[model samples]
Target: MFVTRSVSDLVADSEGEGEKLRRSIGPVALTALGVGAIIGTGIFVVIGEGAKLAGPSLFIAFIIAAVTCAFSALSYAELASSVPVSGSAYTFSYATLGELVAFIIGWDLILEYGVSVAAVAVGWGGNVNEFLKATFGFVLPDAISKSPSEGGVFNIPAVFIVLLISVLLTLGTRESARLNAIMVVIKILILLFFIVVAFTSFHSGNFEPFAPEGFGGIASAAGVIFFAYIGFDAVTTASEESKNPSRDLPIAIIGSLVISTVLYVLVAVAAVGVAPVDTLSGSDAPLAAALNEGAGIPWAGGLLAAGALIAITSVVLVIMYGQTRIFFAMCRDGLLPRRLAKVHPRYGTPARLTLGFGVLIAILAALVPLDEIVKLVNIGTLFAFVLVNVGVIVLRRTRPDMPRPFRVPGVPVIPIIGILLCGYLIAQLPWETWLRFVVWLVIGLIIYFGYSIRHSRVRLGEKADAPSVEKA
Candidate 1:
């Protein structure tokens, strides 16, 4: 259970990097992938929920979350560069911690990425319906456009987007990266348009009493809106696919976060400036609501709906992309069936695993109530981030001689702050979310003991290629 993979083995595995998967991603494309994933459902969908909790000070929550992620991103960049592995935090833990801890984080990440994709898909359905109603003035019946709890049969658009992204992923990695770049550009433009339009009606008076509920409110909202920052780490999962995981992964991870943090702050300010908290938080589509009713700019609201479609489409693509790669890594490690790790001959991608998980996620998006689970997802990702930060400190002590392309400036201090901040956020979540997390972990432990232990390549003393950022 305490077995560890030697760092030498990982460096050896990354040596001839493009054997199984193609390495076509440069820093620009890789950063775009991170941006594509980071700027999705959180900003477009859940920001309203945070607005309700923090009022105009929702922007403050964005800052808090960004600062926390900024610290963790440093640690993530360090481990990501040194390992250049596919599993993100899971891979790092396997090298620094031990197999049992690595498996737990892997299970935790599987939940975080899989559920987030499904939740984002569900939110995509709402945006699709909003766009249709605003443009065609015709709405799909609730029966086919929402979950049963929301007075609908099933969410068709959610499943449709998931299937579409899955197909795109099956085509190839470079193809997906190209499309993600295009979407990232369009979405950024859309956001800038929103900011310009929002400023047209900006009211400084709307920000009176900004900290309505005080730091307590901002902290609570930060716990919720931290969901917005979830995908930055998703960049590290693509290290295997990057042309230079050591150089590019750090750049992509930190660059994507910097770009996204600026947007999040500007958008939050514009949103509250254009409308009162009561009005913006009243509806699910805060940005649109701020435009259509508060700012009386219906046309801009309509266009914003269209931008959301493209934005969320890329998010699903990148997140599903990350999840499949993590699954591929786990399987290749023999913690799951190794055959499932095989890439498609022509596409150089994990075609079957991508499509299989996409379909399952689609089914979940259609049937499950995902709104409440956002916090559950937040706690899981936070746990993974904590492990990654801890992995950095452990690796320093365990392998002080390792070469690092980029190092966190403050060593143990920065990583400790990350762990503490994450712990604080985790504590802010409800007890019920903790209960669900414990149950999930219980099930994962069963699988680990019953199957993973026996099949694990490390425990079996089997020789296999180490997973790296370079695809091949």
Candidate 2:
């Protein structure tokens, strides 16, 4: 019966938990956190890879990804406002979808947060290495800076940054949030510089064969570039801290998506304008390289490199924040150890989980090559987005009268489009990516049946009279 409580009861339960903490974040800061998490190394590095796969149609790919994200954000906004909890989709899924789905979302979230942190950390080190060599006449030895896939040694700087951010996260969320805002400002300013400089060297001839690679190529690029819009959902993690969650949570989520999409389009346009598409496709740092071509400024590349370092750092911080909070929620539900959910006595943050994730991510960043794990992150994120969209409609039918802070304006249509778009993009990933996703799910099943099912707080209590676990 407790497991099948009404939607209002779940909301009340979340409030009881969340109100113990202070609500200090304003809408602006929340929006900045969203932006800080979204606009980073994906634009700097992966956009080029997307272009290589999609051609000029990569622009359309951005729109496709953003629209899909917008649908999920709408669903997220409603759930965040209604529950005002720390766990984001993990909490929402628990209340409405059941323990099994919640566990899968939690498992997929590991990719979203943990894997992403390592990938972004590696990117940060690469950019920092470039800037140091150009400005200080010092180059990090290949033994320390390069990923093994790149034919060098371990990425020491990346591992170092992850360790430092983990310590900061343990110190406090409020402090980490402030630093994230500042990093967001720095990243945006550098992107604007690229936009301004690249436009000056615009050549109409560069866009001649816009869709050189065909529609299938464009679809694949959308799969790859889908990662660029990853952070919009991070806003849901801050739901517990918003002053007026119902009014502000949705605004922060949707607003961040709209803002990021525009910025990405501008950056892409500027990048394509300043250089040939083929040239840009091959670049590891497209925006910086484009600015160097257009403005003839030797230092433009250095500035962009500096921005990439900060941008990647901000992303690592925000995602790590999300990871710990999700772990905290799972722990409280008895799906994980309760000790992992304990908030710091002084800081009021999940220090144990934060530290655990930090150490795990640092180890991952140190040993795993970046190219090996990026696709797994992409597929996991898309799967989560699919659920958010489906869950929106399910919740609507099951509990329509529940208070919705921000309803999707075109509920059925929007969610439907959201579902098809997510499926289409998922279809474009390689066979191995699907295999990896299946393996991840099977492993999650093992843990769930082996541990979570037996230990779950709901299961440990008297069995609810209402239905089976699937229906519950």
Candidate 3:
């Protein structure tokens, strides 16, 4: 019988990146990285839309979504401790599920990280324009401000930011992490500001008919709005670089989830309390607009705009970082060109992949009407979550003797629930999104069978069963 490489083998691949680089990340900074990735434009932009669809029960949607995420987070914590590599679910799946599943996940993550960077870039432009107009009374012409898919000439700023972040990422991971930490601080403070001001003027009446759209709507809203939770997985991508992979990796992954869920719920409650669900859902700048209307303060919009700009920029950086790392992992596995996996001599980062991903994301951000393709991000992520949770169960049975520094409580139950919840969430997504995901997976199948399967490092006997070793 043919056997797939175990998670331990995959983690051992980090030896290529070396031990010095691997120990640069500490637990607090790792948690901050997780939070930086997790909290962003989603809270500022998507929550209102969820509220509109789910009514005041959008709060319930947040809870439901968080619970679903927690199941996966628990699974992820266990795996991150076990594998401790940079590819996130893709690397984990490859070790436990086989090359076919790994290829699909690697392809799926292209949607989660690459596509999301573009969406966030487009969103970043909107916030920047708003900040400019509010602070200095100037706005970009529609020709320059809107994405090509949105009936505009080009979103130059969006493309520019993607390129800039790409360059920054290629320069060094440490530098990028430091910048992201600062931006995360500013963005979190802004959110705290909203909570303080909005709650002072909260209205109980706004919650009337809490589930106006009913259970179906709430579930569907959870599907559509799930992208808000996409970035936390980036935390797991840093496992290889973590100072204490076993102890800190789990804290960073699960701790970020706890922090982000609380922040998301608070932000949603604050936004819904100040405005009607319908109005909040329709506004382009929901948080800023809601703050402006509720507080009757003229500068509220400007402040929120400033915050959103910082929030989305941090998101762009983190996602871009994740994209480069995932691509690097695939290339190192011989699933792609080895040149793409080379670390920058000066920066100790994946320069080629970083620059390549940046350019690709910029073009997509500049040309593609990503609003339509956005839901695929959530679908891809949910699929990854399912695999991760299931991987937890598989590893438990296959390697019962393998050390697990952070074991998820109620193993089989948590993993099973995680799989079911992810499936339910995916089912709630529009049929078109599923079709698009299938199409992407088919393309991945062709690529894998045509080249990757034969070229894989495991197939070449370089390290076969013990290619890479993960720390627990």
Candidate 4:
């Protein structure tokens, strides 16, 4: 049960019929994918939430979150290079820790990626509503546009966007990557536009009390904005699709984190400088609202809103893509139904799993108010990061001779710091969030013990007859 699949065998298995993912993405596209996923909800929506908690010290919060992410990103870079598989942390844990631990991490990732896509979709719904109102003077009623928690019957726009992205993904990975890259560029340009325009109206008084609530506030803000940095690991999920996983995976993972960090810091600084903390906190479309009301640029608000729509769409696309890949890996390993592992004959994508995720995310986006649940995504992601750091340490001690294309600079120190920081962030989450995570894990354990343990191909030796499975 604890047997780990050799990297060489896994690579060989990937070449099997109907299971192979196309290797079309390069380092540039992978980096763009990371940036696309990382920049969405955090910069566009969560920044206001962070600013509310930390005041003008949101910039410091961004730094704190970035530093914490840097530790985990290095670990991810190392593992992605060494493992070069589809399952991100899940695959790493299976190879290092054990199948049970891998299942747990994979389940946690479902919470991270699945719930995040839903949450981002909700955010997207808000921006779509704003954009519609700004552009065409059309408004969606609260009953149809908001989740029940937010006094709406359903969030139709959110559901619509998820389904749209799912269809795009089902068509092909390369096509989706190109569209994602384009959207990323457009959003970045819009953000730069906001920064330039808002900088002209910067007010020193807005930062009077940089840490109004003190260090505690900064810590709280860091926890809030930590969600922004959640997507860099999503790049690792594309390991199978990367043209040169060993070299390109590390570059994509690290490069995306660096690029997004700088943009987040600059955007946070510009946002607070142009608007009062109170105003930003109260806004639904914070950046656009800041530009319209605070900076006195009403026209720019429309442009920013349009950019946010594109930004959130890219985020939903990449995140859902990550979720499907994780599920595909699990299915391939017999942790899930094998049908989920089926790749489309024509598109070479996991069309079935993509549709499945689309349906579930659409229901969540349509009916659930995901504000409180966003914190759950953060806690879940941090838990996965902790396990990943631990897995890196375990792999080093157990497989010292393994060839790693990109080794983390500081082995024990970096991973240790990563585990500690992730643990701290997890602690900062509300008790309610912790309760939900525990409940979710309990459910996963039940499913695992009941079915996965019995069905896992690794345990059953089902692959013993296959030549490729024995090659390594």
Where does candidate 2 clash, by residue pair?
A: none
Best candidate, lDDT-wise? 4
What value of lDDT does candidate 4 attain over all alpha carbons?
Answer: 0.87
RMSD of each: 2.7, 4.9, 3.6, 3.0
Task: For candidate 2, write residues 1-472 as lDDT tens digits.
Answer: 1243245544554455432344678888888889988998888887888788876666787887787677778777777777787777777777777778888888878765788888888878877888997678788988888777777777889889999999998887778888999999888988887888778788767776888878878777777777889888888887776778888888888888898999988887777777777767767777666666655776877888898889888999888888877777777666777656666657767777788888888888877776867655477777777877777887888888878867887887887888888787777778878787788889888888888877786676622222111111
Could you estimate the TM-score for every candidate? 0.94, 0.91, 0.93, 0.94
**Model 2: CA > 4 A from native:** 1-6, 17-21, 53-58, 147-154, 214-217, 375-377, 460-472
lDDT of 3 by residue, 123-218 (tens): 888888889999999999989989766778899989999999988887778778888889988888999999889899899899988888799888
Quantify all predictions' global Cα lDDT against the true fold: 0.85, 0.77, 0.80, 0.87
> How far off is model 3, as Cα RMSD?
3.6
What is candidate 3's CA lDDT for residue 62?
A: 82
User: Mind giving the per-residue lDDT tens digits that candidate 1 earns over 1-472?
Assistant: 9898887775444444322566778999988998999998678767898988898899989999899899899999999899987778888888998989988888877887888889888878888888988998988999999998889998999999999999999899899999999999999999998899889989999998988899989988887887788788989888787898889999999999999999999999999998898877887778888888767888776788888988888899998998888887788777877777777767888787888998899999999988688546467788988998999999899889998998998889999999999898787778878887888899989989999999997777766554423234
Clashing pairs in 3: 9-468, 11-469, 12-468, 12-469, 13-468
Clashes of each: 7, 0, 5, 0
Tens digits of per-residue lDDT for model 4 on 1-472? 4667666666666665546788889889999999998988678788889988999999999999899999999999999998888989899888887888889889988877888889888888898878888888898999989999999998989999999999999999999999999999999999999889889999879998889999999988888788788899999999999999999999999999999999999988998899998888998779988888778988876788899899899999999999999999999888988767777767878888899889998998898767777645467678889988998898899889999998987889999999999887776677888788789899999999999999998787765223212111
Which residue runs does candidate 4 get wrong by more than 4 Å? Answer: 369-371, 375-377, 464-472
